[model samples]
Target chain A: GIQVEQSPPDLILQEGANSTLRCNFSDSVNNLQWFHQNPWGQLINLFYIPSGTKQNGRLSATTVATERYSLLYISSSQTTDSGVYFCAVGSNYQLIWGAGTKLIIKP
Target chain B: SAVISQKPSRDICQRGTSLTIQCQVDSQVTMMFWYRQQPGQSLTLIATANQGSEATYESGFVIDKFPISRPNLTFSTLTVSNMSPEDSSIYLCSVVPGTGAYEQYFGPGTRLTVT
Candidate 1:
């Protein structure tokens, strides 16, 4: 099994501010994805970056597979971005998840 | 991407009762997975449901406690047997379509609260 670790266990920022979350893996992975679990409990797929970088709206992510690390950036954050961000990795058939970074955006 | 629909989006059940969550995928898939996310916790893999065969449970999950069934390629069900308050969490179903690649699409999820 692979180990996933997320940094900045907790983060609080103003609604208009920006922040970055990092995820580190213990072993090589064939697949990697970033997910945002909203307050309503729906896990929204943020990025499917096994390597390289990707952007969508105000959110973006970069995965350095060789370094075994990935980063998620939220620019001009909104109150709706408040929730837990998880980094999941797949090796064989199963995916291993990180504890996640809890983000709180204040108005 | 595959579209998945899960039944009983949310439920509150007695501690002794059981709840079965159904996952339906718009596209046929050979592999389906069940996951549990405790409050404020990371998602944990419950088991891997393979069509025409029994599911393979994770380390902490057992078939007797969380029975899973995959009768076909596009649907599966996971039953939380003899539920407890600790079982209160979001149960999500995910599937991987095609071969060679391993991208997964998840369903909305079922929120369960046992008291």
Candidate 2:
């Protein structure tokens, strides 16, 4: 089984600030995904970047497969972004998950 | 992207009872998984449900405790048997819709509390 680790266990930002979250994996993965679990406990898909970079709205993610690491960027953060962010990697039908970074955005 | 749904969004039960959570996917899928997430904790895979055969249980899970059934490609059920206070957690179902993308979609999850 692979190991997934997320940095910055907790973060706090102003309503319009920006922040970055990092995820490191111990082994190569065939699939990598970023998810946002909002206040209502819904797991929203942020990105499915196994490699390269992708952007959606005020959020973007980059996965360096060769380096076994991924980064997620939240720009101009809003109060709505106050939740937990998760990184999961999958290989051979098994998905390994990071503990997650809990974010708080003060309005 | 696939639409996934779970039944009984939340429930409270007695310690010795059992609860069955249902997962339904709008589209056909090749792989379905069951996961448990404790309060304020990360998700842990319980088992991988195969369509016609027995499920593959993870290290800490056993079939007698958390039995799973995938009768077809679009639906599955996970039963929390002989529930205890330690079994209180959110149960979620996920699917990988073999579209060559390797992306997994999750259901909203069933929040269970054992008294």
Candidate 3:
């Protein structure tokens, strides 16, 4: 089993502000994913970056396998981005999840 | 990548009763997993449902309490038997399609409350 830790347990930002969330794993992972759990409790996949970097619109993620860490960036955030962001890492048979960073965007 | 659905999006049940949650995936998948997320907590793996055989349970989770069935590649069911108030949580189903793709797609979870 691997240990996954997410930073900044809670964050608050203005609608147009930006923020970064980080996740650290204790072991190497074959799969790493960033998810956004919306206010309605729907888990949306933001990125599937096992390594390197990827960007989708206003969101981007970077996973450094060698360092056993990953970072997620949300640029020009909006009220729609107010939710919980989760980082999960998969090893041999199971996926380890972080405690998630709850974000609040004030309009 | 895959459209996943769960029946009975939310339910409230009495203690000592059993509830079965169904998971359906649009595409064929090789691995299906069941996870539990408590309030203000992270997700924990309950078990891995094998297509034709018994499920592989994780530590701290037992088959008798959280029985799982994987009849085929595209569907599975998880039953919480003899549940108590402590069993109240959101149950989610996830699937990893084919080989080489390690990313898992999650179904909109079933929110259960035991009274």
Q: List fnat, each candidate.
A: 0.48, 0.63, 0.70
Per-residue error at B70 for model 1, in Å?
1.0
lDDT of 1 by residue, B1-115 (tens): 8889999999999988989999999988867999998887899999999888889888999999999999998899999999999999999999988777677778999999999
Q: Which ten residues in a row have the lowest lDDT in candidate 1 chain A?
A: A87-96
Best by DockQ: 2
Q: Give me the candidate number with maximum lDDT.
A: 2
List candidate 1 stretches off by more than 4 Å: none
Itemize residue pairs with steric clashes in candidate 3. Answer: none
What is the lDDT of every predicted structure here?
0.91, 0.94, 0.93
> What TM-score quantifies how close candidate 3 is to the native fold?
0.97
Winner of 1 and 2 under lDDT: 2
Model 2 residue A79 CA deviation in Å: 0.9
What CAPRI-style quality would you assign to candidate 3? medium
Model 2 chain B lowest lDDT segment of ten: B96-105
lDDT of 3 by residue, A25-81 (tens): 999898899999998888888999989999999999999999999999999999999
Per-residue lDDT tens digits for candidate 3, residues B1-115, read: 8899999899999999999999999999989999999988888889999999999998999989998999999999999999999999999999888787788889999999999
Model 2 interface CAPRI class = medium
Candidate 1 chain B worst ten-residue window by lDDT: B96-105
